[model samples]
Target: MKLKKLMTILLTTVITTAVLTGCGQQENAKDAQKKPLKVATNATFVPFEFKGDGDSDYKGYEVDMIRAVGRVMGRDIEFNNIPFSGIIPIIQSGDMDVAASGMTITKERAGKVLFAAPFYESKLVILTNKNSGIKSVEDLKNHSVAVQMGTTAADYAQNLGLKTKQFDHNAEALMELKIGGSDAVIADKPVADYYVATEGKGEDVVIPIPDSKKEYLAFAMNAKNKDLQKEINAAIAKLKETGEFQQIYKKWFNVDPGDLPKTAEETLQ
Candidate 1:
């Protein structure tokens, strides 16, 4: 009887260990199935993407929006800070899955990548120190202008025949404006406002250039990723219906998003 009791205890311990090991393996298998969705961004645009103090992680409106979108799709998110100019090429090469760095939707870009629904509306603005005489796009004709490279503002400035200096980051361009390296900084309105507010340069001026063309911001993915684009579109619509998108906008801009497009195609029209 003593021998039989000892044998039974040993058998119980072996079975328990096997069951626990099997359960752990199943959990790890589940974790392994979750593929990460890689996103590329430029972290210099405040209120859109920027790094926090002492940390390399990016934090901003676009970061939060993409994470939320990932949760809805049941995918893990990985964000990479790539140069804004190279974001599309990175997506095209499959090194990254998506680009969400406050990219404007243009016919040219749309031809290269599939754009998700427009998340925000933006326009070009000129930021100058109070003493700078630059007030409009017309005023920039003879002055040295600074713009972030690979951005619509840069293109706009160049097309205007102005002598332009392109910088890697909008902050650097704004700094050039502050130090008189450039007569004016042409950038997205939101970024210009963010710089002015944070730098305590309230005395600086912002001049909005009226264009019949309205620019909308959206996420970009490779042209071949149609299924992923559909998923993203549905996710955006759900977020809008649930008011989650509005909450995100309000958190970042402190104002309502107003009327947003119901679908990605609507933004183009």
Candidate 2:
């Protein structure tokens, strides 16, 4: 009897240890799968990412593209709608996994974040009240132009000898134009066009600046996230090849994308 009792105790101890070990491994697997990708972006840019009218849900081209990326990676995504100024810092500090707010891929930005392949080629344009008499960059010489603080538009206008009024967001600059505090506003062509079409300012504003100054937009990941950057580029290539990219482009802007080199006649005319 003593021998049998001793054997039974040892068997129970071994079984309990095995069960605990299996439970721990199961918990570890669950923990590993719980980590979802987090993408940060400035949600104020329309036709890219913005609060859907009459709802809290986000709606825009960038939002759709990122969703497609999540499907490709087989991972869930969480969007952090931060300000443009905070996006780079958040990603650098490891607070976000990706940044994709129609961010421009410029030399200055490349130094801060790893950029994916160019997603959209954009042009900068100036917007002014139709009655403001500002028909071009040349006309901006004597007028007060408003741009969002810390924007490329602000920097470009300031360097070009225009009197600049800076605000925290493009909406604020547009407000300045509406209130007659500023004579004009400079911004990307898409945002300017969105404001004109959706903000009840179609006849009030016009794109005064031309396409001579164009910029390419891209996604940004932390410099350390080479894997994520590769995944994004691959997905973008797939999107382009399937004509989904062109469809999204036309859905937002009525024009066919003109990124490829234009003929001399097209360029001149």
Please give the CA lDDT of all the candidate structures.
Answer: 0.85, 0.76
For candidate 1, list the clashing residue pairs, or say none.
none
Whole-model alpha-carbon lDDT for candidate 2: 0.76
lDDT per residue for candidate 1 within 131-211, as digits (tens), equals 777767787888999999988998898888889999887667877888879888888888888877887357688888887
How far off is residue 222 in model 1, in Å? Answer: 0.5
Give the clash total for candidate 2.
0
TM-score per model over all chains: 0.85, 0.79
Candidate 1 Cα errors over 4 Å, as ranges: 1-33
- Best-matching candidate per TM-score: 1
Go through the candidates in order and give the C-alpha RMSD of each one to the true structure.
7.3, 6.5
Which regions in candidate 2 have their CA more than 4 angstroms from the true location?
A: 1-34, 208-211, 258-269
lDDT at 249, model 2: 74
lDDT of 2 by residue, 1-269 (tens): 99999999999999999999999999997775456779897777777887865878877877877877676666787888876778888989988988878776666777788877765667888877777787789988998989877667877888888899987656678888888898888888788888888874455675646544667777788988787778777877777678776677777777776663221112212
Q: After superposition, how far is residue 123 of candidate 2 from its true place, in Å?
A: 1.0
